[model samples]
Target: MFKSGFVSIVGRPNVGKSTLMNYIMGEKLSIVSNKPQTTRNNIQTIKTTDDYQMVFVDTPGIHKPKHKLGEYMVNSAKDSTKDVDLILFLTNPDGELGKGDSFILESLKGKQCPIFLVLNKVDEFTQDKVAETLSKYSKAFEFDEIIPISAIKGKNVDTLLKLMVDKLPEGPKYYPDDMITDVQERFVVSEIVREKALRCLRDEVPHGIAVDIIRMKKNEKGIYHIEADIICEKDSHKGIIIGKNGAVLKKIGETSRYELERFLRTKVMLKLWVKVRKEWRDNNNLLKELGYKNVK
Candidate 1:
């Protein structure tokens, strides 16, 4: 019988959730960074084969909320578990599992679906350490399975995919084989710009920032003319984003345009402006306007 299902990836921040999704899709359907809470939305990426289709939902890493945006992120992550066929609770094997992992596990108490404790970044750990991690989590929770994987190195990812497919029940294909993601191109573009900013800036600047696409249009020559504003929480952060003589902003634009062009498969004329929003993360209305709605 044909099999298909939704798989929700849930975990604490920076657990390689996005990396695992990208590796499965074989494309950059979700953005990744060393920063925690890098993914703010529940991104649905589709992987199809001749036999079955698996739709993977990449959620924001769960964390204690310090602002309205953070609250929305955590809710989005939790709500994604509502009807999924499987839950891939990712953990970084290089680090010790602690209260955060426990918190996520507690939240999944009533979930009826099979839960897999995926030990990611296993390439960084020794075999004994991997065995110990398996034993530790096995004792903590009665997971359906404990799978060791390296999201970066592509180790055991295919095995995990096969196991997930086996767990799926017979169902109709929800999306076409050629369709990779449900997110709009505009959203992807905004994320690309935000990823660039996150990689370029340091410290509080990246966390306190959001990218808004003000305009995106194609000219007569078929090249995309795009304009976006980088929103920051403070005026001082604005100056840092622009840098000395507009160098930093220029770099962000150059790198973003390069990637945007590759994604769009055409030339792009990109312009960026930095604006101060004065702690927009704490503002509920502003957070909603930025598309960070409370999922529940």
Candidate 2:
């Protein structure tokens, strides 16, 4: 008999949830950065084999909502926990369990599926430290399994996957073997642009930024032509994105184009423009336009 199920990786921000998904999928289906809340959507990644298939949901980190966008992210994260075969509650090994973890656990209070306390970044800790941390978390919650792993280094990740597969029930495959994620090409391209911007900019600029793909088409010459706009909350943020003599914007475009070409496996001509939309995060229409719609 074959086994198949969905697993949600829910946690606080900057805890390697995206990294773990990318590693398991063997592809970059979600964007990653040092910035918290980088993942704004619930991305479903499918891993299929001859015997078993696992659908993994990568969610935004649970946090306090300061705006409509924040509320959307938090809601998206919480909603992912409703129906899943397992929950991989990821947390940084060095950080102590705090209010964010408590809040997320509260949200999962009545979930029927088993919760796995995944301690990521174990490469930085010794065996004794890992044991101590495991013991500390064991008292906080009754996790079905408390597994330590180094997502970046691929340490014991296969074991985690095997454990999940063992717990999955018999079912049919939910997605094709060749398919990795459910996200659209345009959305992934937009995320690539946003990730590049986050890598290039600093301070409050990245937080206020959103990428909109105005147009994307393939020319007869077999090259993809893409035009995008970088939306910001203030004129000063726009200036920072544009940079002195347009150097920063040029770098962002070039870097984004490089990644897009690699991901698409074709030549890409990327055009970018920065626009100031004051208080876009709080604007419901703008949030919906950016695909951060709140749960109704």
Candidate 3:
């Protein structure tokens, strides 16, 4: 029988939800960083097999909204939980269940779909502590299953997949077997530039920056040439990104080029420019144009 269903990965910020999604999809559909709230939208990745197709919805981390953007992200995450056949509520095994996890569980109280309490990072937890940690979470909700997995180490991930497939309802495949994700190529390029900025910058510089890919083309030499802008809220931020003698911008370009080549499996000539947009995050029109729509 064919089985297809949506599974939402919801959890607190920096709980490795994106990392788990990347590992499951076997590709980097969502950007990963040490920073919290790195994902600001719902990214859908499709995994198709001979008899089952799982559409994994990788949502933004659940957090208290500090701005319009934060609110949008949180709402997107919560929205993904509703109407799904299964919800993978992930938590860090090394950390205690805090107010954030409580808040997410509280919100899912009456949801009809089955919930799976996924204790990620179990490799960091000792065998003795694992049972206690599992017991602590088991009391909070009547989860359909309690799975302890190490997403980074790929431990018990196959078991998790088998369980998820078993729970999936029988239906036709929503996408072809070779299809990977729902995000467009331009979005991928923009995210690649942003990922590079996040890796290179410190403090609040990465948070203040947004990337847009203006042009992309393949030359006669079969090399991909791309032009993108790294936008900041102020001229001072622009200066920081450009650095003295254009050193920082060059570093960003080189790093992004390497990642793009690895992802696209081809050579890439990346050109980056910094521009001051002056608090563009609060501008609804600009945010919508940049694909950051409010989730209401």
Candidate 4:
């Protein structure tokens, strides 16, 4: 008997949702950065085995919205809780019993599927702190299982995976074995550029920027030639993205090309340009164009 299901990993921004998924899938399907809100969409990563399959949905972090894009992200996260076998509420010790955690827990209340309170980053805290968090959340909500893990260190992740597989009912393999992700190659390439920008740009500038892939074509030599524009909200931010004498922009392109090469398994000749898109977050049309569509 084979079991298959979708598991939604939900949490506050920067709580290691994408990190945990990347660790479990052993593939960097979602981009990771020090910045919060780095993942803007629900990325489904398939982990298939002879006994079971887990389609892990790495949802955007749940946060208070300041713009249309933010609203769409939060809604997308909420929608992921539906029609899934389990939910992993990933959190760290510092956020234990905090208002942000409380808000997420409240929204998760009465979910039909079993909810797992996954306490991440346990390596950063003491055993007592982990116990304290577990005790508090156990009273707050009756979770199906409570597990602590260090996603970066690969601690107890195997146990988490086993438990998740056990919770799933017998079902069919929804995707082919060779496929690792649900998103298209173009979307993944665009996210690679955005990830580099998020890592290199200033804190404020990263959030104001979006990446648009203008063209991507594969030549006969199996080399990918791609063109893209990095959209920012202000002239000053554009300068920051471009950096001194285009040094920062150059770095972003080189790193992005390296990542694309690894992901696509081909040489990537990437070209980048920075453009201004003032308040694009609030513009619904631009938001949709940037892939933040309404969840329905």
User: How close is each model in CA RMSD to the real structure?
Assistant: 1.3, 1.3, 1.7, 1.2
lDDT of each: 0.91, 0.90, 0.87, 0.92
For each candidate in turn, the TM-score is 0.97, 0.97, 0.94, 0.97
lDDT, residue 80, candidate 4: 94
lDDT of 3: 0.87
Candidate 1 lDDT, 1-296, residue by residue in tens: 88999999999989899999999888987999998889999999998888999999999999998887888888989989999999999997654668989899989987899999999999888988888778878888989988999999999998998889889989999998899999999999999999999988887788899998999999999999999999999889999999999999999999999999999999999999999999898887777777776632
Off by over 4 Å in 2: 126-129, 294-296
Give candidate 4 misplaced runs (Cα > 4 Å): none
Per candidate, the number of residue pairs that clash is 0, 0, 0, 0
Error of 1 at 91 (Å): 0.3
How far does residue 138 in candidate 1 sit from its true spot (Å)? 0.8
Q: lDDT, candidate 3, residue 199?
A: 80
**For model 4, the run of ten residues with the poorest summed lDDT:** 287-296
Candidate 2 deviation (Cα RMSD): 1.3
Which stretches of candidate 3 lie above 4 Å from their native place?
Answer: 127-129, 294-296
State the number of backbone clashes in model 4: 0
Report the lDDT tens digits of candidate 2 across residue range 1-296. 99999999999988999999999999998999999889988999899999999999999988998888888888988889888899999987664667888788777777899999999989887777777767767887889988899999999999998889889999998888898888899999999999999999986888788999999999999899999999999988988999999999999999999999999999999999999999998888888888876634
What digit string (tens of lDDT, one per residue) describes model 4 on residues 41-118? Answer: 999899999998899999999989888888888898888999899999999865369888899999998889999989
